[model samples]
Target: MAILITGGAGYLGSHTAVRLLEKENDVIVMDNFTRSSAEQINRITAAAGRAPEVEDGDVKTKEDLERVFQKYNVEAVIHFAGLKAAGESVEKPLLYYRENLQMTLCLLEIMEDYQVKKLIFSSSAAVYGNCESMPVSESTPKNPINPYGHSKAMIEQMLEDIAQADPAWQITALRYFNPVGAHPSIAVGENPAGTPANLMPILLEAAAGERDAVDVYGTDYDTKDGTGIRDYIHVMDLADGHIAAAASQKHGFHVYNLGTGRGTTVLELINMVERVSGKHIAWEAKARRPGDPAENWADASRAERELGWKASCTLEEMCLHAWKWKEEMHKNTQKGE
Candidate 1:
């Protein structure tokens, strides 16, 4: 029985694939390689000493998914294939919906056709748009402020509806907090195609001279340092949470918050990265982007109680591993040049 992972070559997807492979699970990776790469599979192979079968295809194209279903003995799926940028999604709402929601619908249809019942959907905390309280719980209201979050919320509801209709469908949506950092090996991690978006990556890119300077979005928000504060969980910890969710005994539609249950401000995170990487990073303050929140962290108690998992990595560890990967990638690029 193979676990099919959509967008298995992506940042979070690839990390989850590595963990699944390490657990001795037969894995099938389906990706379009638009915002990913086949080399990610190579890194997975190196890390786990085993790699998933790669299907170079898109989920929106039902034919590609059909080919994978027919070829492999898929038992469960972890869907992560989609455009994930909230800021970009604000500019192109239709594009986000067309790719994320439509592809999810196609995957669900194919899974039903193939009689695959188990699914673990990758979700985001943005669904709880600007929660009035701190440490948002799983019961947080679904008030997405942007197109990207709305797309995720819609799919989550669709999964809920499906679960209600069928009792046997095992589904769990892991609403992830800010997923940062890289694999410790420096062999596999995010491969930025251009300028990075997230804080950790952008900070690392600046340290490695890949970018001019990191832009601090929203410098006055009434937080520790007036910058946006978020729960920055390491990618590996998030991957482990997915594994726990997949292996859980619980059934029906469920939601779990995978986070460190702590908030770190932007300036605080930048300081940690600088301290860990030993690089005097340069940064500039910029206005708050649309759909941005002042402060948001997770009340991940549900995941701990249900999945028997919690993020254990420290902030320094996250910064250290991320910098290692960034430096290694920069060295590789220099060699290529």
Candidate 2:
């Protein structure tokens, strides 16, 4: 039986598909290229030295999903289809609700029909919106502030209920922190469409001279350098966490925080990128974005203890990997390849 990855051409999904393919798993990728493209599949093929069966389909469409389920001997699914921008979700709450929620609902119904009971959901730390504590854990109260986070929390609850109702269903929701960096091979990385809302991508853009200056939001926070601190995990480490989740024998619904369990300030990140990329990052101070947290890390001990997974990449390594991808992409664009 093969593993079916929804939105497999995306940043995280592409990396996970590469890792699964490298592990010799029969993998199939289903994507419509809404936020990604076919080039990601090419890169995945190049990196894994093998290609996954590609289905040009959207997760929200039943016909698109049914065709793949009819063709492949699917054993498990890693759902990564959804709109991710928090600000955009806030601006278009209905779109977020309709797209993100409907995609999962449709996928779950089809999976039930096919008797594919194993699943690994791509969730986010935004579900724990503005926590009062330092490091967030799996048990953190889910108080999502925006539609994007609300959609994720609602899907997680739906998965929990379904798992409780059915003994055969095995589900894992991996709540991810800020996933930065790229694959060491420079085969895949976080290259979002349009202006990126995340800090890592923005910093990379500034380093690549695409943007004029990086905005240092809220420099008066109580962090060591008076900047927001976030737990930035390498994308490959996150991909490995999914592999561990897929290989687990544990039953029922499980949730794990995928992060480095450490925080890096904004200035600290800028310094690291400059040090690694040899490019100076110019920045300007801006007021705190409304809903932005002062500090947010992760207590990923449960993932280590349960799934035998821990993020081992250093901050410098993350910066270096991301900068390397940016540089490579620049060269590729110049060559018009």
Tens digits of per-residue lDDT for model 2, 1-337: 9999999999999999999999999999999999998899989998898999999999999999999999999999999988999999999999999999999999999999999999999999989999999789999899999999999999999999999999799999999999998888888777788888889989988998988999998999998989999999998999999999999987799999999999999999999999999999999999999999999999999999999999999999999999999999988878997
Best by TM-score: 2
Candidate 1, position 270, lDDT: 84
TM-scores across all candidates? Answer: 0.97, 0.98
lDDT of 2 at 253: 99
- Candidate 1 residue spans exceeding 4 A from truth: none
lDDT of 1 by residue, 37-80 (tens): 78889998998888789999999999999999999999999999
In angstroms, the error of model 1 at 77 is 0.3
The predictions' CA RMSDs to the true structure, in order, are 1.2, 0.9
Worst 10 residues of 2 by lDDT: 187-196
